[model samples]
Target: MFFKLRKPIFLLLSIPAIALVYIFLRNLSGYSINYQVSSPCACYKCLTDSDPWFNYNISENEFNWWKRLQTESRSFGVYGTTVANFFKIFPRNPDVIQPKPDHCRTCAVVGNSGNLRRSHYGPLIDLHEVVIRMNTGITRGFEKDVGNKTTHRVMYPESAVAVDDNTHFVPFPFKIQDFEWLINASTTGFTGRSYMPVKSKIKTNKDLVMVVNPAFMKYVHEVWLGNKGRYPSTGFMALILALHICDEVNVFGYGADSDGNRSHYWEILTNKGLRTGVHPGSYEYNIIQQLDQQQKIKFYEGLTKKM
Candidate 1:
């Protein structure tokens, strides 16, 4: 019966549906996507081992071999040889040697999930110096994911808002809004898009918000992501923050189940079909496994799924 009068009913529903879509689009809109970047065509020579400070301590023969490998790796189909070169950016403080904490910090990267409403992670999240979140609208029923202990909220303008003194806003420089944040960040770090809005918003002497340069993203991809050179989405971003800032980083509520199937441990609408993470593509499950092996991070794998 609904289909018998299909065209008329379809036209009737379209008006409200169109209005709803417009509202959704406004909410979703943010930085202009960079389309110029194609796949890495040649070795990114800028981030290379040939530089004067290319670890001169290693023997000439070993260094030569390493250089050869770097080039050959690219020729044969390898990427990311420059990941270790970040020390050049911020040379490690040899004076303050030990970075790994005696006890690993349990920092959670909370996802947007209504299921966390009563999960009770406020105090736990507060303990972490940083709690990375994405895709705002969090101040709602999901108390845990958008914990009261929100130390850092990293997003575009649509997501930025009044956080407490400790709550720092780290917005990825994508469009005009980012330009505004950059102006305000005492200091900022950029991976690529440096002309972000944050630059425009600076008025005082607040340090720049640390930016993970696009070059760094490429480096991270090479170091962690396989030769194809694709980067882990925001998951890698969180890991990179831990790698740079904290001695220990604890991950929570990530990954599909043990079956390696795509399913949200978080709740979903009954009418909707299953939706996978918009994060890094591929066996990030495998990548996370490697990160665990290296003791780089600890995943709070749900009790439902285990080793």
Candidate 2:
């Protein structure tokens, strides 16, 4: 009778003691559910030990990478801020997004190689919110290839060509003296390398230069050369940049025609005997086809099919 009564009392005492010891050990261990506390770090990396400065008023539990991605995703097509700042110093004015519309913003990108002189796609190409062309090859003749709807023209401070003042002009400030050197070079009436002087001073009436994102450029090179196993050219990068910045990107006069003939769209004689100009290699073309298949952008080939 005495042993049976002691057994019931010992069992009751053992249950609470075990629970206390387990609680003590859990508090001691870092990974224990009852021990490891919430972190203060704002970066998305979790399961880390570093204690960052956490906002006391903000809800610690609410912060996460998913939340940040969602926020950043909304601001998706904006180009590099670093590139935009370079042009801020010269001709302090707002940059115009061409084919200017109140509701939808569209761009038509034109390349200079004399290929666009008479393609007659100019009026149709003008249907965009903005029309972007590089260098100064705009004329009414090659309307098909160059597109007559030139809204924005990109130029270097050192371009060896002249662009009409009435149209919107964009200067690419790639280097430190891009604005100063190019502007000075043009002002001083000295044509050096890739720049030509204007006859007279014209009013600066254009938006900021559209800058190439270094990160985006790296992404393109990596995707093409390192990942896709090919070298990407300047025009290929330009197309990629348009795809990233604009909502709807349409490519015209890029690469050779449908028959794999190596010819210049600009028709500038590069010694038809010596070397045929090339835009993209077969591997880069494959990557572009992949991008098109993924519906990342739309590519239209203005081919005569006579090759």
Candidate 3:
């Protein structure tokens, strides 16, 4: 009787185990099983080969090459003089301040999606060693959702916001005037004018101001994005930047919300017709999804399943 009972029990337990194996194999069939962590550094050669989406560090020669290309394309403005003058003031790239130490750095790229409102990702996001936020995504009232800590804030001149003293204000300059704007804003509070008016005086640590290289932007557009849309959006640029600086990257609050609308988590949108204009939203989404699937980056899609 003991021998008979043992066989029956073994069969029963083996059923679930066999079923689990089948399920696992089924899911694993099409997926790439090799899980490799991405490197934290970036360079020109690596950008083209391993990951085209990667943003590499730019040299002064590369910067000059890009500017010359832009000049030949007739898209270049008086950027040469403006950038030279601007560098004379600030001189060095602020990214040099935070050198990559001999340790793994986990970074979180936090986007502003309404799905994050109730996801309770604040605690998880704050756990990262480096948290990069973009634009006007504030943490004052939305601390419970977006977290209160910000290590780096990426913004263009138009979307500039006030950051804490400790946070790095990384400016994504699109044109010559944008570079000039940073120098003036840092020192004289903008005595010069441009095509459009920008914030003359920004309240933040001047030393922590890092300007994104225009050459980097060009690389992102032509190489990474394949000149997909009008231009690479701020979020996409920030994502690439994080990949270059952080060993492990976890992306949050990206993609369409639960209702499938492109809206921000911090604001209310009554218009459903509003879409991400001038951006290749669909193409970019597919690329991000591919990155997640490839294990190059970990993407947290903040949506709850309906039971």
Most accurate candidate by lDDT: 3
State how far residue 129 of model 1 sits from its true place (Å): 3.0
* Ten-residue stretch with the least lDDT total in model 1: 4-13
lDDT of 1 by residue, 65-130 (tens): 333422332210111213222222322221111222133333556544333344466556657756
- TM-score for all models, in order of appearance: 0.48, 0.52, 0.73
Model 1 TM-score, all chains together: 0.48
Q: What is the lDDT of residue 109 in candidate 1?
A: 69
lDDT of model 2, residue 69: 16
Order of quality (TM-score): 3, 2, 1
Q: Write the per-residue lDDT of candidate 3 for residues 68-176, one digit (tens) a residue.
A: 4323232333554555566565524444323233456678999887778788889899998889999988887888788988999999777888888898888876655
Candidate 2 structure quality by residue, lDDT tens digits, 137-185: 5455566556566655655554524444555554433332343344444
Compared with the true structure, the alpha-carbon lDDT of candidate 2 equals: 0.39
TM-score pick, better of 1 and 2 = 2
Instruction: Candidate 3: list runs displaced more than 4 Å.
Output: 1-77, 96-102, 191-197, 304-307
Total clashes for model 2: 30
Query: Candidate 1 — which residues are off by over 4 angstroms?
Result: 1-107, 113-121, 137-140, 144-146, 157-162, 174-208, 227-230, 257-279, 303-307
Best by TM-score: 3
Span of ten consecutive residues with least summed lDDT in model 3: 4-13
